[model samples]
Target: MGQRLSGGSQLLITAFVHFQSSFIFIFQDYLEENSTSIYHDTVSIGGGSVFPQIQPQSRPRTESLDLNPESSLIVEISGAVSDKDRVLFTIHTKTTLPEFKHTECTVKRMHEEFIWLHNYLVEHDQYAGYIVPPVPPKPDFDASRAKLQRLGESEGSMPKEDLQKMKAELEAFRSLFLQTPKIWADSSEYLATFKKTVAMHEVFLQRLAAHPALRHDHNFRVFLEYEDELSVRTKTRKEKAADFFKSVSKTADEALRLTNQRDEDQFFREEKCLLTSYHAAVKDATAAADLANLQRKTMAENLLRVNLVLDNLVPKERLCTSEADLVSVLSSFFEGYQKIQVRLASDEDLKFSDTLRYYASDAGAAKDLLYRRSRALADYEAANRALDKARAKMKDIQAAEDAQFAANDRFKTISECARLELEDFKVRRIKYFQKNLVDFAELQVKHAKAHIDLVKSTLDRLRDIQPASSSSVMKEPTDSVGVPATERTVSLDDAFGSAVPFL
Candidate 1:
């Protein structure tokens, strides 16, 4: 692995050097071009273009460390209340910072409010160098609700026991839907949506709190410390259209910038390539994980159907006593098995699959940071060219110099901050994966143990059952008809192996 990484690094360096040399020659040719033509064709400093001009801030002498020994901001989604189509999250903020109105406070925020905050951060020029956390997706329970409706429509055909057990499980889920109104309390769909949205929101807030600079943002403070509704409204059609076009322009600019520019910083160059590969790999992993979870749910549903069939069969008056007894045992076994399968699927989705999905978004955010820096670099180069043109033409020399200096300062600041942010990202990403993977493994072990116990108890119950007649009782099968006695016996290792083959 070390050798491979070293070789990749060498290739990257070689390519960068080659590109740099090629750019120098191309730039010399452009410089040699008639200054009059260049001056006439070049856009004015304030002219609208693909790359927006950024106003420079006073450059900091030293990069601020993402650490606070004296005080730390802690934020959490304490509870959530669900309205008809909206959820109000109770954001609890605790800190010792004097900047806040109170050291501790709680505020209610809706999903739209979260969107407002995320957009505020993204649009703010001050945060251009930072990897702003991705906006939490709007909570949508339409699919879950549709599934519930289907389940209700089919309830009559489903066995009474299975229906009751499923309802009971949903009710248990409702208990986790903290402070939800009675109207939405009984809804499995609402419960799931509430839990998922709350988790995403919590992660967003936690990330902001942990960031040294973002935690101090005035808008973030208001979001956490203010008690009333933020009164944020949805964007109008015109605004949405504008944003759409802006995003399209940005996409185009990113591709152009990447093609034309070679990152002078080796660290950023390697990070750019690493992030691209990581994002692709994570995306593929997420799809596979989702597919596996879907298959598990389907398996559970099929098991439930079989359990229902066995249950219906056991009650038939025509069936013999021994046959009914056998059907009853099988039905009971399947009931337990299906529940275990359902729980296992949910666990995997929450712990493993969601983690991968979240990191993929995070990786994208990191890549965006790189793109911003690249855009800054492009701007700096453009400013330098304009300055040279101004000097050659002896026109607006002071204005051109100011623009060049501002661009240079902005580029340096962004590059410095970006390096620190990416390093922190690497550490945080590793820690997050380790913790979640460990928790997932532990949960798998717990579920597998439960599964084995269920099988063992079912087997014991089957052995205790007596035949109703001689015809119903069969002698032990010979080696030719079935597995020999030694082969039939399963050790603990075999049980575990059978229960969780992936593990």
Candidate 2:
């Protein structure tokens, strides 16, 4: 959490981020330029590769957040300080909805926590509780004896034991006790807390959005500091590297079991043998792959930290700044692009697997394998560009090498997969040319080299062979006519010249 000073403000501002996966698009004739209205949806938001939409999975959205008057759950809040205002909000918990399941503890938890809210609503029903969710839990605490017996073994155990055992256990627990948590959580139990809180917040946000007082008032804006998951992930990566490296010393590693394909001996020269299928599927890897998954699950404090930071800063940052003050105001915008880059980098890297498999099937095809690899190749180029950018931005942000990353435990099997596909395609293509289609095969073999040379010549825009060679990343331009190389130029007249002398 490094601090940077700006303007007259000496207050500390670490990296702040906001990512709105849930957005209500607004398009209005009255507004010349498109303006953002947080909760009020002029248009329902949907997501794909570019635009991420809101309502849930792949289809029609449940309810529109239209800013028009027809929208449900309108709320109005009035009188507050700037974005940094410390105004309290009351939320009633119990409500009857047909679709909602009557969960036990949540119902009771809601009743106890919002008793004051219920009281406040009774007196000032008009606006006090408008922000409360439409479908909230009924009062009940899920502490059944059978429930405790079944669900409480791993987490709910521990005899006070002896003093040393208690101290050691507590100490061990404290080591990695609280880290990156889920996105949404109250002081409730962990089972389904994150989803519940977000559901409740959605309704509240909608209601507060429509509130006449909030909509009209300039000062009482409901500034939302959306959590960008990047920071948590970034910190997670840093922590893993630190933890793994900090305690371990440089040790001579054991010999790795790699089939040395290049090592030729007096014994034999054979083509590489590839496995038909990988045994320990990447999803079941015991080491790096598993660790990565565990990291995703155990991320705890960072999540909480981001939410609290958001809660504090959303109101504060918006007070004197406009959204246009991107880098000038919020640091999230500065760091977020890196996250986006990393995501793209990761996807491109995975896509390399696809590219390898497809090309292995048939690299000659202009459309199928070659076209698909175009994206992969572009990703490689993009990765280079992104690396340069990141390195320029941050002092020492080294990008993981594509080749090395591809060789990681998760990706090693992809090689085997590609190899099998390549063998099959080669056999099928060669067999077709040799037996079934003699004329086609002969023509293909004859023209392949010439066609490849022509294509290369056209690409290079030179008649003669040039000194400058293309990157080996692309497949070597092949023979236009056939499967084999025929680089030596031969004249039929030379062989017959001796016989022709007598004639």
Candidate 3:
């Protein structure tokens, strides 16, 4: 395998390759015109003269001419200052280019400063609800030094072209806020104010750095490092929450399965059995009613034959009196039977089995609600466990490394917040289930009232058809078979025989 270059060297080589690619595009037209020659010595690949020098375009200076305090704010990063241990950057700002003095800074200090500027701008941008001009990234002093070392070059004796490129990049970085058209379009009024504020903040930071007492303070020196730890905690919290939701989603699916199973096992089974029993009772009742009607029609015909015989054979006055009495009894018996038979037929035809369906619905709803609550409780418990774990781990970390105490405190706060949210969810779920239970109870009461009213109506119908003892007493038929039409009188007790319990 071939030896690989370091990341720094690779970055420099990549930039070089990109520049060469652009050069190829620009020179392709010239090469096409001279295709007759297979080889050419004047084809400069680096920076020689395959192409003629082009004059630089002049741009009108847009910087303010007045030397006021706000307009005096300037910024630039000069080049690298390498040592045996680390590379330092030379920064220059706060005046016109000619008057600016260079200041040396380490990479770590510059990174912290850049982070401060970037974070402040981002926070303010969010508050204002618009984009702000962005700060340039910290200069890559170490990378530049490493690239130079790989090429057997020292910082003081770098390639002229590379030095020019670095200077150009720094110039662009300094002019980013003022020269970019996008910044002006985004928020014109805030641009100058933002620059002034950044300059003021930089001055304050410099003042703090100059103070002996505050220069070595942990709070001042470790802001960026602390922020990194906080960011890690935030990421971990989000991952835990995402995992919880994923697990709860699967629990919800399992709860749904349980709910459906309960419905099938309990209410659905009861409903099916109810329908089967009701239909069977109705069939048997209908058959009984048909038989009773047939018997009544036969009795009527027999009574009419007896009446005709009495009208022809007996003495006219006595026969007429006896015939009227017997006919009256027979008619009363037939009417009573018909009335009860009609009620039975109505009961069979109506088949009011809504109670069974209502119960099925109620049971299904209850099962679903119970299962949901069960799953929610499980999730709530899981959240509690997670919070406990976080708290325990935080305590361990806080004891293990004093530097992590602040991070542990933040994690503890996050865990407490999560716990509160879970408690609120549990409270809401309880309220919901309680309301459902109340509604279900009312539903049962309403069904019960309807059932009682049906029984009362049936009883009233039975009482209305009860025969009067003296007027419709039993009597023997004129035939010697000793049969009495009144003896066949149907009662409320007999009307419902073995066919009413399901109803």
Candidate 4:
């Protein structure tokens, strides 16, 4: 506690003041307590304002009314620091003495030194002894609860036989795990080779699929061959699996890949073949369409020739017909060329997906399909034949119509020729038989005129004689008059073979 003596000085304005040697706590409790709270307020002594009241302390230590020579003053002090260690300092408040404040003095202001110096509860010589840092505890490893659980109930004790048996089992398991290294190595090598083979198979299938000819073949034949080869391979599980209680470690997808290897490959191959054939078929059909048009043009030309010949008076004939001759007449595209082409395509007998099917089943199916195709082709050929016959019949009808036209033309020509001849005969008859001979000559002219009529009638009769067959082929030959060449001359036989007495 800081010592102070308060007394009234009555004799003179000057009074004796004594500084106390007690331990002075240097920090202002009011300043320190309010150091963090209210700041110190300085007011002029002449101004007559008490420092805004610091919270009242427990009791007043001393009181004095000093109206001395210098000033009137009241000092209040509180602190926890021991004053013996610091030179006592004071701030002059209630006066115009700002220079008296401790903070007003600036020396070397080492920022933390002053506050920390104030924190000592006692002098450094009074501090007891050296402080030691606390040590952290060591961690336990073997004693871990997890290790105890791993040891199981056997941690405390176990029967020897059971112990022996477990030891033996562990030894046996370790041996078993190690025993097949050679076999495993061989299998590993085999698997490596198998992987390469599989890679080749995949590449081949990919190439086959990419082939322009094989895209749509649903069976994928080239891929199927790889599958067939895979099926023939060793499929037995590894011997190591028997020793292991662990269920086969292979996943379902791996097992399936191994198992269906051959089957998948087989399907791909068959489909490829079918796709190739279909590509070829499409190419063929286009060319066939063009050929068909050209044939129709030829047939039109031949028919036009027959039309022009009959326009004149010359008789149209099917001379020297033969049933077996090669006429070089073109086929209608569908019947002649296309039918042959479709047959060629059929003969390829390409087995696509169905080739992978059961042999008897595939054969039976093929046979049935073949039968249908053959029957259809046959029916088409028969229709083609019927069409050919109808076309030939048309020609015969046309020829007959042509012959009638020819006959009409001949009749007109013959009548015109006869009329002109008779006109000439009349002139001659009148001149040669001067009335006497005219009658005989006129009768001769009538006879000759009658013969001409008979010749025309014979020709008209021949034109009306329809042939038994209208085929382009016939062994018999006919002349331009449509009479058989070897036929007895109709005019000679009917008109002049014998002349009887006139009726």
On lDDT, the leading prediction is 1
Find the 10 residues in a row with the least total lDDT in model 3.
Answer: 125-134
In order of appearance, the predictions have TM-scores of: 0.74, 0.17, 0.18, 0.13
For model 1, where is the 10-residue window of minimal lDDT?
59-68
Candidate 4: residue 82 Cα off by (Å): 99
Indicate which candidate wins on TM-score.
1
Best-to-worst order by TM-score is: 1, 3, 2, 4
Predicted candidate 1: what Cα RMSD to the true structure?
A: 23.5
- The list of candidate 1 runs beyond 4 A from truth reads 1-71, 147-193, 316-320, 472-503
Q: lDDT score, residue 424, model 4?
A: 39
Error of 4 at 104 (Å): 99
Better of 1 and 2 by TM-score: 1
Instruction: Estimate the TM-score for candidate 3.
Output: 0.18
Show how many residue pairs clash in every candidate, following the order shown.
0, 36, 0, 26
Worst 10 residues of 2 by lDDT: 16-25
- Model 4 agreement with the true structure over 72-127: per-residue lDDT tens digits: 22221111111222211111123223323322221221112222221221112121
lDDT tens string, model 3, 1-503? 02233434333323322233233344454446754233344343574644432232332222211112343333333233224443333333343332223222222233335445434533331112111223433333454335445444444576644454344323332344346532212121123222333333343344333333333344444432222322212226886698689769857776574334423224334533444464455455556655654565455445434434333332334432322333333334333343333333222222222222222332332333333333443444445555566677775543334434434444344334333433433353345345434434443344334444443443333333322222222332444575534444433234333322110
Between candidates 3 and 4, the lDDT winner: 3
Off by over 4 Å in 3: 1-54, 57-72, 78-91, 94-109, 124-127, 138-503
lDDT of the candidates, in the order given: 0.71, 0.29, 0.36, 0.28
RMSD of 2: 35.7
* Model 4 error, position 380 (Å): 49
Model 3: residue 155 alpha-carbon error in angstroms:
20
lDDT by residue (tens digit), candidate 1, 146-218: 6457668979897676676566546544465444443222233335445667777888887787788898999
